[model samples]
Target: MVCVFAIALLLLGPNPAKAESREQAVDRLTDYLFYRVNSQLNNRKLQTDDREYIRQWQRLREAIDPRVKSVQEVCLRVSPQEKGWEFTTINGETYEQTYDRLADTIFYSRHPQRTGQPIPTNDKIGISEWSAIRREMFLSNCGL
Candidate 1:
């Protein structure tokens, strides 16, 4: 009985080095993108620059790295701004952000170019972009 259980475990357990499927890769990338956008939204709303918030944001940003290994990776560039930072992804996507300390607001934009102009919108932009990307990913490969 012990031998049979051990055999079952060997057959059923996950392998650490196995490659991810295309569907899984797409789903993971979609989820990571959403999480990254959501983290920015949270960071924009806080009244104070709490340490925990920064830590959480960093975690979410880091999570994106592992997913990139499953797909074709491109260039990622980051530039520090006066108030925030600009991030550009491999897929021709760029995020430019700025914070208005006096108004306590965050403004940002998403575009395909590295030096793309920001739309100067609020946090709701993140939600809208997330939904659009989710829908596109779902239709592309995740739905299959």
Candidate 2:
């Protein structure tokens, strides 16, 4: 009975190198993105010059690396509209963006270049553009 229990424990134990499921992996990535973005915004609001937010963002970026392939394949498989606050890849880089109707502002770590006109505020933009900005921000800031 002890031997059987030990075998069962080994079977149930964690595997450090195991790949996470798509949902689990994306969820992890999303949490990291959310935390980093929120912290940066909050710090900005407080008028603090803290750089701790950058460290948090880096941690999230590292977490997403292992799950990139899975995330890319899943993104291709799903409809764009159906993808919510999850990690998706563009140009072989992983990024986190949400598409909920209630989201008022989109956050990006990196600012994009514009040709002539200034970039419109989040409330005035389309979803596609917003998502593209999010990806660009992730790539620029998260070191992806």
Candidate 3:
């Protein structure tokens, strides 16, 4: 009985691995927003006016803003894939944006790049602008 209790205590002991801090969480949320915005833009088969795009951007901003304080200082890394893009923030969080051009569907996954580097490709997409827009939305919604 004592041996079983000792083993359980060892299993329940505080994990040595450090959990992600709050700043890391904020960065992750920012990266996710960026990927989502890019995917949405790429998958809109019908040409959307600036106003409609802005509305969509606002919705995404609202969805992620509450979880983070500031987006301006967020550092982003973007890599274009065959069908879309993948993004990561300086805090080590990552996400992917895949656009189904045929079906006009946008798929987003948080931390899709956690296990490996993004696939190599030469496809160029408007990554900087998307990152900027994400930062702006985050700042506006979070008052930062």
Candidate 4:
């Protein structure tokens, strides 16, 4: 469904006359993608053990990596697959974006209200790494 919607958007092109706001587009895109990923995670959790579940989650990146880059190009106008493209997010907040941040905005919202979100990635960071980043940030911010 998201792919179909994305494809429709690409085919239709920007309707400068009466288009939805950019912020609305960003929220719709990210929210739809996040919901899909999380829904898959929930289903995978039922069928696999912890290690396997994490593996499946990370494997998702391999498939989505391209679609995401396409979004950056077609929908986002951020240059095709440009790793450092930045953009505004849902709540009038913005981030100096990278491929990872654009893909993981849900996990790293500018005004994130949750804590200790499990970092999901492909051949990249994991719980241990997230823990280190979390603790290091805490200590660095409250330094001696």
Candidate 5:
């Protein structure tokens, strides 16, 4: 059903005289890509484990940018094989982020280069090396 709607919308692009807003486009994109019941972000409705991951990411953002007063909204960019989230402020800055719950690590592209080394190709970061990169990102990008 969503695929059908998406195809129709694409075939008939937004009215040239009046464009759809950014939020509308994102909502449409989410629907087109995934089929699921809309999930709410209420903390009381979440499991303990799920809440812990949320806390971790919240802490990460604070460590990165303490001046961020409030987050207006979040959007998830999902694929069948992987998932990530985007946080946006009212001021229009977006932080595209992904978290690995098992490894307890977060990846964001704010700082592409790892400290003290040339960025490597085909890098696979896991628990062992997460600390170094985490520290590098915190110091360089996050205000920590």
Candidate 6:
């Protein structure tokens, strides 16, 4: 019986030294948070909001080397802003601008008007632009 239990444990458990890396764990957590929040907010949610959220988790991922053993530690180290999470835009803008833009798109259908300029449909946010895209966010909002 003891031998059988030992075998089961060996097969089921993560190897101690080769356990999940912090980045993988953080990615898993980020995915779960994104899923739960988007499920609740439904169509009212913008997928990009997870950007800042993942950044926070990545900070935690950097801070801690070991796999998380308790929710308390994670909670202590990371918590969402009581208000909208701070985020910026191509120009200088706060999370409020994103929120207002979202509102205009959803509630008012007046999203086309941005600072008296029509929303540029030609702008494509691609992988090559992520560095520049996040540069403003990293400089202005992300404390990390």
Off by over 4 Å in 5: 1-11, 15-48, 67-127, 131-144
lDDT of 4 by residue, 5-115 (tens): 999998898764544454454444444444454554443323445554344334333323433222343343445534321232333333322334433433444214433
Per-residue alpha-carbon lDDT of candidate 3 for residues 1-144, written as tens digits (9 for 90 to 100): 999999998999877665555555544554454445555556444344665444444444444444343233333332232121112222333322211110111111222232133323442343343343434332222222
Ranking by lDDT: 2, 4, 6, 3, 1, 5
Per-residue lDDT of model 6, residues 32-65, tens digit only:
4333333444524335666654443344333222
Cα lDDT computed for each candidate against the true fold: 0.37, 0.44, 0.38, 0.39, 0.35, 0.38
TM-score of 3: 0.23
Q: Candidate 3: list runs displaced more than 4 Å.
A: 12-19, 38-144
TM-score of each: 0.25, 0.28, 0.23, 0.25, 0.22, 0.23
Q: How high a TM-score does candidate 5 get?
A: 0.22
lDDT of 1 at 134: 38
- Candidate 1 C-alpha error for residue 90, in Å: 5.0
Residue pairs with backbone atoms closer than 3 Å in model 1 (clashes): none
**lDDT for 40 (candidate 5):** 32
lDDT of 1 by residue, 10-35 (tens): 99998656555644554455344444
What is the RMSD of candidate 2?
12.6
